[model samples]
Target: MEPSSILVIYVTRIGDTMLVTPAVRALAQAWPKARIDFFGSRTSAAVFRHLPFVSRVGVLTKKRIRFKGWLQRKSYDLALVYGFDGDGPFVEYALRVSRQVIAFKQRKESLNQKLLASIDKTTIRCSNSVDYLFSLIAPLGIPKAGLHLSYVISESERQWAVARLAALRDGGAGPIVGLQIASFPTKGYRDWPVENFVELCRRIRSEHPKAHFLILGGKREWKRTRALHVSLSGCSTHYAGRLSLRQTAALMGQLDLYIGVDTGPTHIMGALHRPMVALYHPSSPSRALAPLEHPCCHVVDHPLADRGATEHTPMAGITVDAVWEKVRAALSGEFPPPLVTPWTP
Candidate 1:
């Protein structure tokens, strides 16, 4: 069926929302004239507004009757449910409003297995989130668009970033290195040690002598960012909790290199196609969500990630020295081999 209108749902965080770009692009390319609507949270919807392919971005906060009335008014021809946040009223509403609903099974029970059997079957799986999403939409006959991640930064936003960075630029400051010190609380295991970040910044600057650092994260990370600021002092600019997401992205686009844990901002930086060193722990494997298609996205997984780690893997295993090697390679437009183990350097 050639659907005239389509609705897609994925209310996850920035990283999860960003991974759907290739799939979204695939839909747009396959049906150039189809109006694509995205159902996500405010932040996630904000991310989609930048994509020209998106016609409307809706949030599912209160689920008021008015909201339901408005959504029902749209009379969407088809609904595509993404992996996370695909349950509750949204799913029920998708089933109600759209002619066809395509979603993955949310449970392992017989009921869900049978429910999913009635829909299209997902025949492929991949460690990479981008590919994982493409598989969900494969039944629509949209092939993999490309591995590249995309974001739209407005001109005003670019100006804001330039102005913000200008004040921090010293007469002799070396390259600008962006650092994301913490991850979301629920995924704290993915965070690299703050002391490691402080030490890594010190060591990198020691080599560059006058390098500058920009610390990036959400407001929840103020404590860590504050502590890191105290340690690095004048050498770094703390933007966590201070700027909007797009503004932070705008600033990130101007950075020479980014060093950070596996977090949403890291994904945003990747979509901006900036050079970066993205860290990961066994809590979440790097392959599943590492920056895709970025020319210089270097992922440094904790050594414990591969060595049969069952419990949470600590960030302590990813040494400053090990990450520094990848940082050096990334800054030089090169990449260290697949896994950045301590023995690599």
Candidate 2:
């Protein structure tokens, strides 16, 4: 195959869309001249604006076919759909336009099979969602360059982030730490206790008085951020629900450290090479997505004995002390540091 010009369609959550960034980079590496485009939801699309590897980004809502005819006009050589469950209209839409389609489906959709150049097997064992997507591209012979997640910062956004941060610290000295405490409410179980974060802030302030904490999250999480602020009193500044996704990424990129649950922004921070500590639950597999090929990531997993009970919730069995150990290791210079040592309990 000539590595036909690719259009990678990832119309899922922000994190899922971000994870495709490396795949975009991979396509660019394989076919430098081939056009590479990323299609995403409107909110997620904002993050791709100035990416060098992407020629264009077509933002659309689920089942909104407004851009379908336009995409067909481009005559994409190949299309890959990330969130299709085999029956969605978008699955058929991608099939209708692209010369070749590669996708994953739960079971045989007669029409889907007819349109696709290839579909993932019905019974392939997988531990992570991104791995399932990667399987589709293996037939194309594209080497797995680990999981790719990126947030392209325009020059204007970069300037905004700089000015904002300068005002926060008044040109003071300290490690700027970005802390995100809430995930979507549906994944509320994934959040570490807010009290843990409060205590963490207190300890950080006592030890490293120069250090400053910047809380980040969406409007849905504002109450949680406020609670954390109340508990920590004078220790941190709350930037939660204030900045847009790209603005937050720019702010996080300039930070000395980042700590969060397995969420969209955390994935972006990972792509930018920021030192990160990710809290994981058994429901979400960090094995497939944990800052691969980057030595600066540390993962703490709360293992589950009964897989049936795990459902991407808050990590249980993990304590504040354990989290603190990982934070200390990350601050020091250990690449892929251990989340907890043998005697931490």
Candidate 3:
């Protein structure tokens, strides 16, 4: 219980890495003097760059030698393993580094529970992943504070956002709507069809003539996003593959509203508590990943009727009209936020 130094390992995708922030915050709040270090992917590590609670953020690479060396240099009182997959090897390293170890164990894994204290993955069934993480430290006597997400932007970052958006900031006449057109390639089904986004944009421009779109996504999306950029030409800025995560987040913070597929930056927007509309595919349920604690954010979801049927994308079931209505409500202060405590499980 008295852990002076902790090593938290969660080597996963960007969204999963950000999901760990609330747990990290709980640890910091409960033990203010404790040194908290994160062992995660380099790309996702940027989200913690300027965060005050984390003392160090370690990036895992192809070569485990340097990572092993770093772990050897510090002795931790506690080790927290977070990712659902490939944690078997990390568990060994954690045992070597710490006097105590606790982790989130997948339900299917047959492990010796006596090896370490742990919470089974199926135990917490909160609609919001962040809330599930908040629940993780509770048995350790770390009380739930509130639903939260953390991605603090610096003043200089704010200034950079301003300078980069100078053209739009020139006393723009209408609302700024940011768009995250695609999810990572693996979850392409989560993406609203590019053609659907184009149709949605047409409707928005028809209603609000001066509205501007800021397109966001990773570099791999560049080839695919080019068409959307061209289709929505003159009214949007494509930063899909251009900016760093923090820079994209700072710019996303400036949006009057955001419309995006469920991805990492969508979580960042949630952290900023931006008024937004988030879209999700049935395979990746909105209940699990929708941004938490954004009062005005609404999830316009279209899950597949047959959960396993893949005749077409579940996203296709979400009509452009349905999304537009949500967008209109969001813009006119008519968005119906999620019903509080909506989770049945």
TM-score of each predicted structure versus truth = 0.88, 0.88, 0.89
Write one digit per residue (lDDT tens) for candidate 3, span 1-345. Answer: 678998887777778777778778878887899999987777667878788999998886535723563436449888887765543666656766777777766443543253366777677766667767655465577754345678889999999887877777685746888999888888777777899999998898998898888889889888768889899889988888888888899998888889998888888887887788888777666667776656778887774633774625557888998899889888887756543433221
CA lDDT scores, all candidates in order: 0.75, 0.72, 0.77
lDDT score, residue 128, model 3?
Answer: 65
Superposed by TM-score, candidate 3 places the C-alpha of residue 292 at a distance from the truth, in angstroms, of 2.1
Candidate whose lDDT is highest:
3
TM-score of candidate 2 against the unseen true structure: 0.88
Error of 3 at 229 (Å): 1.0
lDDT tens readout by residue for model 2, 183-251: 777778878889888777666666678887889999999989888877766657888888888888889
- Pairs clashing within candidate 2: 189-313, 189-314, 190-313, 190-314
lDDT score for candidate 2 against the true structure: 0.72
The window of 10 residues in a row where model 1 has the poorest summed lDDT is: 336-345
Location of the lowest summed lDDT over 10 successive residues in candidate 3: 336-345
- Evaluated at residue 298, the lDDT of candidate 1 is 86
